[model samples]
Target: MLPRGRRRARGPRPHLLPADARHPTGRGRADGRAGLPRRRHAAAAGRGSAPRGGRAGARAAGPRSREGRRRRAVSDFARVASAADVPAGAARVVNVGGRSIALCHVEGDAIYAIDNVCTHDDGPLGDGTLHADRVECPLHGALFD
Candidate 1:
């Protein structure tokens, strides 16, 4: 404390939020969403039972929908590269038809492919680092599986 000639310099005032406005987990909005619009899933609100995937209430049975159907075959996938091309714990960007896809090699026997563009910022997903089944975006650190 200054006795007579000086007072302490003060910084910016601290801001406070209402108790109800604070998230219970202290990581997101008060509603527990990470800044995304709330989904209307009944189970989320504890109002109704979650739909069974075998029931898969997401769509109705119709020509345009396959809510509870099985495909005849998965023979349409084109073989773009061999597992050797994407080694273990690495990624290889390849063109299938006309789309740029990233083939992530996990362990030694599993390989997963996804769009080469990052879902968060459209960065090059293929150029990112690979860990198990997930990839870290090179541009913004977003992780995708």
Candidate 2:
């Protein structure tokens, strides 16, 4: 006499990767062992296509390293939010021209914008704490004003 209820399935399970991923690539990640095949990036897959960050400026080669580049004023500015969106003592992160910018509302009627990357460790500054007119990096205790 035996009493049995629900039983677990004793079979193979499906995973996210395909079966071909098991092939060796003569290298491994973080160790000197076998590694999976590397996938080609879409931007560099074709010869007829442009490169990833688009072509650099035509005059961006050879010189005193571009004091003249500043002659071209930035003519494009994207509006991320209005004054009311970021209240006082608050910070908002916005992407402008593929760069992360932190908009901080300080005191009243004044808004400051800075790159949302910490200089010390490249941490996200927008996710950090806001104090008066400075931002503290979340990863470390680095502060920016």
Q: Identify the candidate with maximal TM-score.
A: 1
Model 1, span 18-86: residue lDDT tens: 445567675566654444445588766755654654554444443342554644445768899987788
Q: Please identify model 1 stretches exceeding 4 Å from their true place.
A: 1-69, 73-75
Candidate 2 overall lDDT versus native: 0.72
Top model by lDDT, which number? 1
- The clash count for each model shown is 0, 0
Tell me the TM-score of model 1. 0.54
> Which window of 10 residues has the lowest lDDT sum in candidate 2?
26-35
Cα deviation at 75, candidate 1, in Å, is 5.8
lDDT for model 1 comes to 0.77
Give model 2 RMSD, 1 decimal.
Answer: 14.2
